[model samples]
Target: MIISRESGFRHDTKRRGQSMPKRHPVNQTHNALEDEDSCAVYTALLADQGSTRSELRTKARLPLPVFTAAMEQLHRLGLVERDPSADERLLALPPATAMIRTCGDDLRYLAEKQERVYRVTASLSPYSRVYREMPSSGGITASGKRLLNRAEVGETLRDLTAGARGEILTSLPTGESEELFTLTENALRRGVRLRALYRSSVQFNQSSARDTQRLIRLGAEVRLVEDGFTEIVVIDRSAAVLPLRDDAEGALVVQDPHVVHFIVNAYSRAWAEGSAFPVRYRRQQVLEASDRTKHVIMKLLAEGAEVPTIAKRLAISPRTCQRHISEIMNRLGARNRFHAGYLVGQRGLVD
Candidate 1:
């Protein structure tokens, strides 16, 4: 087995009977030098479009053997192209294409893929050994917080959830969580307790509402709360993830016992206050904001309030209140205020 330099995670280097070379494998592990060297080669390719072995070696300031190995690794990873008909020069893939195709839509899997690539080479470079020898910093500091930028969040968060053995809790935002659905599903399949909290608005969104309903059917306990929440992901009470702020461009990871407990407590309180995400919360379950306002007005009309009084109660202009009344009547196909009141009763919008 070869231990990953990033987090000391071990993956079997042996596959189908392959073995690590008898050389100083640690010294040959992939690290900073290879990264710098690859960048130099890529930059050169940008200029000439297709770089010869000699050209790349010169540009990267690497010897023949080192250049050869680096190019081989890059080629394997689909970062560069070598066409037989186009000679032996290296052609870099377009940046967007290379990134999306190689890393997919998320940056989480890059580390595992790199580990597999290095394992195939079977010998670590001196640069890699030096990186391994360096003391760890930033992750799990003495303060028990690990700070990561937006670029690092996906991978680190994925790693945290993947290690869950008992439970996973997530408070999702308004946006889609397509990437996390599979991860959560996997945890459930492993008999891990899965619970998720979402904004009440999500049940009104067709796509996400479907996703939550699907999750519920699959044994995930999904609930909804309305507003005043931040994104938090907790794994078995051992770790908690919080985005740095609303923008989600960075995150603060909490592994300290006190901090993790604090986050879990908040989650528990929210969970207690939330409503179950009804699989019955299908299409059009929630009315539009304006529509809900109309219903509110209907109740006021039902109670025999005049337009001026309704407008004051709702904090809208009387003209706006009259407009909403017209809209509500139009929607309910009512003849007048009395008929609209009758429709509201029929629809059961309010007691």
Candidate 2:
């Protein structure tokens, strides 16, 4: 006769069957094996019991052959019995109520220990050695992260320009824009040195009479260059603002010293070769001499006259000379003065 207890079974036979189930080696070994197999099957079932074969394949992250072999092994061991009432591929397990009850105290102990460890580690995190020595590169600094909205942008700019003692280098596509002029003037009044590069068109457009006059009166050093470079503003060789969006609504502020140095170097090179913004226009200008002012400008440019010198010889202000040159290149759809000259020569305008 076999009598069941809460923890184990008691058996009585004609022989000396007085031993407890816990002391029976054969029964203990079998129970241990079943427990081990049950744990594995339970975990897998919990992960994907109600899922389809395709879902199981994805969740298991195993190859098809390996997944099939695992399922077959589980079925043969009786750990996963088939669910005949449902789909043929579906399987189920007998309720593990008794086994789970036996391990409840041990599982609870482990869970409590894990929670304690997590709390202690989190409490000590700020003092960690790795965080203390964190390296700095190009990403946002702590201060920048705190100032993220439009309202704070002005404060950020003020802080950036506060102690800027060196020259600020900038390039403007539309130098005549009023906002840009105001910003430049503010920087100048703050005693910050200014070096600006403007597109050739802004130099000569008589339509922007007041803007040109104001720029000249401010005595802000200016230059005219022909290129597709967008607006670039570098402050004191330490920071730069480069527009990320087409309309200049978004910008990436670069605080990396190396990047700012590279940008400043490029700006200096362009400035060194660029013409200065002239104060006033003269009567006998190179631009006024020919009906095809663009062709004449390209011919002179190809002859290797510096932009400032060309402006002087042409009798117009240097800005006006640059504007004429820019127009010629655009009409010919040329990349630079040299290219414009080539196209003009092709048309027999210049030898």
Candidate 3:
């Protein structure tokens, strides 16, 4: 039996009638300069620099086929050269020199590839501009407003937030989704200033409280308001998104500079009237926890909100809400609920 070292193969040399050890096929596929066969041949040649090809195969202990393949690959890599003075002898180049030559070739190839990429992109620039200027099927209106269905709002908001370089102002009455929470986190990481406004009653929602706290920790400014406010998102004061209908079935994306500026002004006014959200954290907390529920109740009462409505908004029982209302009425020395609310505003309590 003949055994090949690097290839890990055993060749049986027995006749048909004789019992012999297991035989395996020889490996002939690998011929790269880095393979074990090439490495063995190179090392042998290094030890005896001016050796002939036949002497290298004998010293390397590699089969003739493997030795020939390894030598061809080494020559291609400039690691082996013909010794002109010696008849059939081979000369081994310094490994460092060969590596530098190979790397220079690879770098030149990569530079050419990168240049081709730039040229291809430049050729397509005009088509990209044309695509952006073309109108969508039914999403864009004549007024330059794009209509987005409920399913498209999240995608559009993601794109807008990703591209936003300046401040992002948002007023959402129904609270934000977890997907939006993640998207906003990414925006905040990019150093974009964010100011979000939500209904004061959202403080009672455990989910919203957790998400809002995380956002605050990431340098977002949040506020709570009790009075009327519209749901909108103003990005960079250049674009605005609003509900297309009262039911929130769709959205209207406005990019008209004048319309966007108007929305921005309205948002600014509402934001000024809002109260800072009480973040439960260390020194980074925005506001100290106060009787915010009572304050909100006062505002709702002034707005003529009923007992059940106030209770639902505050996430409390109606009986508990009535008790608070009674306390307020007694403290004001008022005759009726409406009269108590009148005194609350008359005394400038909600301010």
Candidate 4:
């Protein structure tokens, strides 16, 4: 069963007497029979879409007949497309759009499946004269569960994002997904406030930079934190999705109000400290904060404060404080740490 933060929508796609329903196109392409060249072609195109027929055949390593068969099947399945307007026949499809559509289809299917399961389970239980009920946590409603695979986690995120109205908050760990970019872009267009935090390291990658720029242009408040963050998605402060465990392939979806509130608060604090990464505002916050720290450190150093004490005041390391002191001395053209202080007083840089 599923719990939607929007309207308490409970849905299930699992069937007790049968295997799980086949995935929609987004996932089915990955599970196609390996012996069929269709799977190979699909995977090749997935890695690099808009490949010419020749390029695709070379990448998939399939004979002409096999390649033709694969492309035909993929096109039929809606996982690939060949534009009639373009004669060159460079096949293409936006995988992110396909994923969003598949997610929507599966969600609707699951919602119906959930109702059917409850009917079946309740009917079987009523065979006993007295209504034997499952033990429950009663009014607590602190329910939580693990999404066992990437597909489940992705579906849940799609649902929460689709339903999000007030806001969507995210901490990106690996990088931005085109799928996520599409979702957030649509969300912003729909008038939902969006904010995201990522590691400072991502600002260097060309592709990541483009994606970040696109998100910011679409009205997302994007920022970068240095450390102590994890992947999290909070929707309208009503639900949260996070990894089930560290480096796990699973996710935990929480609807508990208190837990979601705490997670949102943590995100706010991190956002406040994050450095802006745009070309016009690259790392302004970190530099400004460093200047504030340096200002205090200079005053302390001029009073003959030891490295360890200055470090304590600035919440930095003794070695780091010593390095700062060294830089200060260099700036003042002083002979040593003691001389740096004398120069500071003479220059009237500090009171």
Candidate 5:
């Protein structure tokens, strides 16, 4: 059948012959047929078609009995078939489906074992413990257990102010009185770095202008931004306090690091993007003079004062009064008296 010599079929058959014992023909025959060498020879011979028994024996270099034993094993293993098309003298290879089926079974067994191991590991993980103990509510209360009153909150703030070596971030809005202003000034006089943000509209008032100037001289930074809410105060990076209500009675003292860090970041972003309060104050002061003059001229014009009457009342010439009215219309960006009054009201220039 043109079987290659390198297949080791011939050597295996010969080894079985040399190991056989005499006077035990039946036992020797069964043992030789069941041996590993016999199985190797059987597998090799099945791979070679059209091979005669004599030819197989000659190639395998084995005696008749050993060769017959190997051929019988090949028949038992179902690796060879008697080829009826060739006078039943030759052996044929088994179909490839059997070998592939065995390999697929082994792969499926390994995959099942791996899945079982993964399921067991996941069930025993530490995250499973956390999941079992979730939704807990026995920690600190909203009003802290240690500090229960305003007096305690004040003491804590005083300690924070004393320990504040660098800078402070605060938003102080003037309301019924200037209590916050006094507290801010006290901090400023202590040489503590202060960065303050106030509402833009009130920032130009006479009292606010003087207070802002004092803060600037004390090395405090100030800005004005569009206001929506009350105030936010962050002292150093260690602590933060926000009023729980708009009336500024009770405060929420934040000691959690993550929450305080987020508050500080929000304040820093607002400060950087905000307008300069001092510059807005200066512009308002400069514009007030022209605004007052425009108001006087508008009143006289409404009262039907002649040009000479207006000039005498304003202590200016008739031509100068007319020029002033023209300048006021241009400055107000108004087309008529109604539009001028609207613009003035919109600008919040009137008392």
Candidate 6:
């Protein structure tokens, strides 16, 4: 006979003529194996087949209290059972049988819970219908807001971008999405001014970089921020859509004028601070710092600043500073940093 517990209910599966069902060993470890003392008790009982609790405890060399606890654990795990014939005698189930019984119990419990959930859901479905059909004042809902699922969010974004007239401001994370690229492209084609912020990490992703390059080529202004804010889209400074929560696949669309204005202002600040996307220069084009960066580097070099000092002053890496120094030397036909500084001073580049 085998015993199992499902949702605190016991089930008995009896077999004909209990010849101590063939003990089939299982190579896989069970949760019951985690307890050393319980494992010791189970091992001893498995070897001896049928032994009184006290006899097995003595054979296992465990104290009474410890053995009792181990036996309790074994019982809970369905590995050991009290003999129906004798009060103190016990029987050890085959490892495979115990595993099967335990798994069946868990499956039964889950089935019961799933049935209950289905019942509850069915009972509330009418209420869900009523809520969906509930009337609104002036056909208006809660503060010009809509909660949209993943698919709906994409469709709604496409609609918003297609209808946009003035401008679109968007913040993107570290991955590329075909939906975003398509919508952004459509908006730009309508002569809608679009400023997009992408996480700096996105530049490292080949596909996302390609998407960004396509957008830039289509006249969409793109910038990279150290940490991109949550994925958002603001259309014509009148509406904003963002994720409802980090873990949720739904989005929240907000159209309240005040709220939209706040989101647009916040986006403006981030855009102002974000760095322009790096230009992919052609082979013949020279790589040099921007005019402002070049002017600062020139001033620093004239001050006899080291590479590290120049880098810190310009918020760049020493390697980049050194590269700029080399470019400046080549540009001025100079041989070294000292000569570069002399050329800059003579050309009044810093002034």
lDDT of each: 0.72, 0.60, 0.78, 0.72, 0.61, 0.74
Clashes of each: 7, 2, 0, 0, 1, 0
Q: State the RMSD for candidate 6.
A: 16.9
RMSD of 1: 22.1
* lDDT score at residue 286, model 5, on the 0-100 scale: 46
The Cα error of candidate 1 at residue 160, in Å, is: 1.4
- The C-alpha RMSD in Å for every predicted model, in order, reads 22.1, 20.0, 23.6, 25.1, 26.0, 16.9
Give the top-scoring candidate (TM-score). 3
Give the worst 10-residue stretch by lDDT in candidate 5.
Answer: 19-28
Q: Please, what are the lDDT tens digits per residue for candidate 2 over residues 1-351? A: 666677577645333533322311112333554454445444666665665556655665666766675565554444464356656445545546434344455566557667978999998887564543443332254422222343344455556656567777778655635555566677778777878877554555665545756655666677765442457777789888666443333456777777777888888888886666655666553244333445546777766667786664444568777787887778789898778766777777675
Q: TM-score of the candidate numbered 3?
A: 0.48
- Candidate 3 lDDT over 1-351, as tens digits, reads 878898879855464554432322324465454488888999999999999998999999988887888887787667898899987999889878876665665556557667978999999999777654564654576455555456678778888899999999888864567777788889999999999988776665678888888899999999887643778888898888888764466677888999898888888899898887766545423232225567778888888889998876765669867887887788889888899889898999986
Q: Is candidate 1 or candidate 6 better by lDDT?
A: 6
User: Better model by lDDT, 3 or 5?
Assistant: 3
Q: In model 6, which residue pairs have backbone atoms overlapping below 3 Å?
A: none
Over 4 Å off, model 3:
1-148, 281-296, 299-303, 307-351
lDDT of 4 by residue, 1-351 (tens): 668799998745354664345665433444345336777888887787677788889998988887887777766556676657766555556666655554665666667778988998889776542422222322122356556667877887888899998999988854568788888888999999988887654665578878888878878888866452678889999988887655477777888898888998888899898877665544875576455556667777778888876654444558767877887788889899888887887788875
User: How do the residues 1-351 of candidate 1 rate in per-residue lDDT, one tens digit apiece?
Assistant: 777899899877576775543431122367897877777777777777777777777777877877877776676456788755678866788867765665563454445567878886666676555553443654444544545465577787678778899999898855237777877877778888888887665665688877777777778998776542568888999988787644456677777889889888888999998777766633455454455567668888888788887765554568878898998889889999778888788788776
**lDDT ranking from best candidate downward:** 3, 6, 4, 1, 5, 2
lDDT of 5 by residue, 1-351 (tens): 234578735322134343312221123346643576566565556566677777777767667887787777655544566578887567655546433333455556557667978999898887656643442532234543234346655766666666776677787554212544555567778777788876554453577677777777777788765432246667777677776553344466677788888888888887886666554435655476445556767665555556686655544457766776777678888786556556666676545
* Deviation from native of the Cα of residue 254 in model 4, angstroms: 0.2
Cα lDDT for residue 297, model 3? 80
Query: How much does candidate 5 score in TM-score?
Result: 0.38
Residue-level lDDT tens digits of model 6 in 90-132: 8998777877776765556557667978999999999777664
Task: Provide the global lDDT of candidate 6 against the true structure.
Answer: 0.74
